[model samples]
Target: MISGLDDVIAAETMLSDVDGLNGRLVIAGHSLDDLAGRTSYEAMLALLLGEFLQADTAAITRNLAAARREVHAYVEGIDAAILALSPIEALRAMIARLPDGEDRDTAYRLLAAPAVFTPALLRMQQGLPVIAPSETLGHAADMLAMLLGTVPAEEQAKALDTYLVTVSDHGLNASTFAARVVASTRAGLTSAILAALSALKGPLHGGAPGPVLDMLDSVGTPERAEAVLAAELARGERLMGFGHRIYRVRDPRADALKAALQQLAKAGAVPAGRLALAEAVEGAALVLLRQKKPDRALETNVEFYTALLLEALGLPREAFTCVFAAGRVGGWIGHAREQIDHGRLIRPQSKYIGPLAA
Candidate 1:
């Protein structure tokens, strides 16, 4: 048996393809390069759900806006006690309160939960009242409005939309696999999504982006990048954004988000010097990684630019993964339904290496 199911084809999907060797990602019928900055998050969601659901971009935009308003009632119940947990934990706790189902309405509710809950949780923790979601605004725009209590600039909204689309799905990842396994058991979409969120909570999965920002904070400037990164590597600390388990070449999503970050910088949403420091750190990290581990392909991954993009868009680091869920929940729901339609009970075999009983 393969350890950790390395290179195992667990399931076939029409949703997204992750070509690790070439560092390419395709969602539904579109390449990541085509979809990221050009397509709206609502449109991406429509594409992902098109096979099983009939909603188009406009329909999705309207339904998702309504879903946000529906989920706000639950956000209103976040007490002082719930505010004590970390943002992801608080987000999880709130999501757990949503009912389970296998229908389209249920799917939309699951899709809207994180976007509605995350900003509210952040506000509550900061002793600020949670801003209600606007039904007229689009998904990314409304999420930004909720978080900031003001209308987001068009460029900022577009940047967040790009980020969401860039990460909407990858083929059979840890969390999406978790979602499918739970779905295989016929446990309903909410259970599947919660399982996925638990997997994403692990640092190896959805946790890296936050730490990339931390690394940037530590590096402080372009001149300090090499020294800081080299020191971290010398101490055997894995550089947060330098490598990915998949992708032998630089991740294409990294390029997608780097472009978005540059746009934000051009629009004056992010400082030019801050963007320069990030670029310097990325350049230095690549050089140091090559010099240190010549055998491995430790290239830039999505987390590097994801950190900068989200920070520039005004999301605190702690809420990064929550926002990730907002985008990925569409995929989770789509994959859950796909498994329900075409998959069976996912019971894999074990080698049973333990000693025999007497």
Candidate 2:
């Protein structure tokens, strides 16, 4: 059997394609560049859901707004112990409690859960009052408002909207695969999305952005970047933002987010020094990686700028993956529907090599 199912073409999907060799990501017949920052998050959702959504972008916007308000019910009256868990864990615990269904609304509701639940849990963890959701604002603006208790600046909201669109879908990555496997069981949308969240919690998948910030904090200055990266390389530690498993060249998502972060920096949203330090670290890490590895093309990937962008938007590092989930849930729902309509049981066979049983 192929280890980790490498090079396996398990599903035929029209949702998204990751052209790893070319370092391009296509979502619903459009390149990631074509969609990032250019399309609204609701527009990206409509594009991904396709016929399942009846070509109605307005319906999704309404459903997500309503669902964001609805999911607040999950945050109230919870155990104090559960409230004290990290934001991601608490958000996951709360989301899994959502009522399951296979209706179109079910997909819409689950898609809104991370956007709504993450900010509430974050405020609670930080000893701040949870701001209620706004039914009138668009998804990104409403989410930022709910978290920070005021409307977000247009640039801030636009940056987050770009991030959401850029990451909405990629090929059959691990969490998406987990989502489809659960979908193959004829499970409801809630169950399938919960399965995706479980996989996303792993450090290798959706957990690196937090550490990218950690590395930046540790490095602190642009002038020290090369030395710090050299020490990390000498110790054989994997650089957090320098490599990707799929993209042999630079991750296109990295460029998308970096562009957003640059825009935010130009608007004076992010501290100037940190952005400069991050850029320096990125250049130093790329040079050192090529020198050390020689064979593998380990270029900058998504988590590098993801940390800076989310940090600029005032999200805590602990809550990074939840924000990622907020973007990715739409993709998960699309894959689940595809699997349900067109996939088989998803059970793969394995061979035993440990001496034959008597």
Please provide TM-scores, in order, for all candidate models, with all chains considered together.
0.98, 0.98
Residues 188-251, candidate 1, lDDT per residue (tens digit)?
9999999999999989999889999889889999999999999999999998888888899989
For candidate 2, write residues 1-358 as lDDT tens digits: 7888899899999999898899999999999988888888999999999589775678878878888888778778556887888777887788878888777778877988988888888888778899888888889988899899899999999999998998898889999999999999988889999989889999999988999999999898999999998999999998898788889888999999999998999999999999989989999998999899999989999999999999999999999999999999989999999999999889988887899778
Model-by-model lDDT, in order? 0.91, 0.90
Candidate 1 accuracy as TM-score: 0.98
Residue pairs in clash, model 1: none
Q: Which stretches of candidate 1 lie over 4 Å from their true place?
A: none
Best by lDDT: 1
- Report the number of clashing residue pairs per model: 0, 0
